[model samples]
Target: MMHRQRGVGLVEVLVAVLLLSVAVLGFSALQIRAVSATDESLVRTKSMTLVRNLSEVMRAYPEAYVTVSGTTFVTAAASDAGAVPTIQAVISGSATNTVKVDSDDISITGTDSCLSTGIKTVDDKKVAKQACSINQLAARDALMVKKIATDEDIKVNVTTCPGTTTQAIQTQMCVITAWNSTKAILDDDDEKACADSNGIYKSGSQCLISEAY
Candidate 1:
């Protein structure tokens, strides 16, 4: 009778082990889903910030955006055109642009573009905040975005169609901004509204759309 009781105890232990294994597997799956959701949220937030930042930059400096047809400024680090650190966007008049992401320089912008104009002041006040170069503002904005985005691909697109901006000088610029975070999980049709059929990247990355002139 003692031997029979020992065998029954062993069977009970085996059943408990099997149940524990199943519970662990279920917990692991839930953990994975939570992590993936967090990643998606982070990617979307960062990407949207970049888009809004760029639009504000352009709206603040209308002159620079028009002249950005061939200006290739460094978008990362404290580097200029020739002093570029590694690689960055080559700003142009094209509709689409690609920029590398970095999260190491948050306070890289906010420099007064009109910081050197003591040429002639009012009664005695120094006219330092006169007018900053358009290119300078654009560069500052791009750098801020680079710092916000870490190891992500940011795509910017400007659409000036079906709109009109009557300018005293230069062509009309009814500009619109559309940006995409390629690293995020998005539907294929999300970016469709921003580009033509040929411009699509075919990657299902949700696009946060905004418009500014």
Candidate 2:
């Protein structure tokens, strides 16, 4: 009697190939997703590191170096040669003796002078003899000083005198006035956002079980 050849049918072979294709496709998708997640995480970590480095540079500088112009401290790169960097201080207000009316409805006036008056007598006899002379000299020196308006509303007055002796004086003044009827400009939002989206991982075939025979 001739025995019938036993072998997998063409249909069975095709089914097996289809199943294998499906499994391979699923694994490929999983691999692609995992790679994307890892890339996103790396980008976020880099951004965080950059921000941290900037913060460290800022911390090394003194608080006096910070200036508030319109509710923000303008920052620049540090120039220090040491491990801790340094930032230069910027003058926020108007020039040395200038006045400015800011958008915040505030008016500021500054005054500067190079010469002031003080008495230095050479001796008791000179003091007694120059008491009256010094008074007249002080008045004359005051009249000789030049006054210049540095700004539209700011003024600078300078005085100088060269006698048989030498004396030095300096003065600076700044005044800020808020416009009572207007509101000052305010900065409410001063923060950075996350650099990128968070990464995610989904369950794959490894999480499932095989059928039992």
Candidate 3:
């Protein structure tokens, strides 16, 4: 029999430690990726919810988006129309195309007046609760969008659907949402761009486009 084997060799102990460290590092990387994916999915869900709310409001007040000579939809003539202004963009990359509603304008009192206090009846000599105009309703709708976007910390861009022109009043509208992420930003000429000049989305971008008729 040999005199006796030492408890363990230094080389063997160092190799075991190295192997454990490698395994731990690999697991850590996987955990990080999972967390990132989960976060992105949550943001996408929030974006979808915002789009749904906006679509419902638009459908409820169809007259708010008046058709101009059976062609394009235009806002009615009203002072509050300026509150929900839309900037027509020739290209999808135009920064001005993005319309962010001012959260500061959100006030229950301000909207209450727009809802039920404006027209006074001379015959009754009392303030009659008048129905909100299409313009006022539209302004309210925009504010709702602003509130949601602010809460979600995202950006929204509303425009006519891609490959379709505003020449037709019935053209589908697109609600595009984007947030800060590791993925590529919305741009042109890049394979990873979120949206092209036509407002169509590509893979690998952190953006979601929802279309509503």
Residue lDDT tens for model 2, 1-213: 134544547678999999999999999999999998886566445434433432333233222122224322322222322111111111222233221111111112212222224345675433332232222222222222111112222111111111212111211111111111211111123111111111111212111011110
Which one is best on lDDT? 3
Tell me, by TM-score, which candidate is best: 3
Worst 10 residues of 1 by lDDT: 86-95
- Across residues 1-213, which tens digit of lDDT does each residue of candidate 1 receive? 886687787799999999999999999999999998887787667656666665565556444422122333323222223222121222222212232223111124233233343566668865554444444445556555554443365444433323333331123222222334342222335544443333343444455444344
Question: Which runs in model 2 stand beyond 4 Å of their true positions?
Answer: 1-8, 64-213
Ranking by TM-score: 3, 1, 2
What value does the lDDT take at residue 115 in candidate 2? Answer: 26
RMSD for all candidates, in order, please: 10.0, 25.9, 7.2
Model 3 CA lDDT for position 108: 31
Which prediction has more favorable TM-score, 2 or 3? 3
Error of 2 at 194 (Å): 4.7
Residue 212 alpha-carbon offset, candidate 2, angstroms:
57
TM-score per model over all chains: 0.51, 0.29, 0.66
Indicate the worst ten consecutive residues by lDDT in candidate 2. 204-213
How does model 2 score by TM-score?
0.29
Q: Residue 47 of model 3: what lDDT?
A: 84
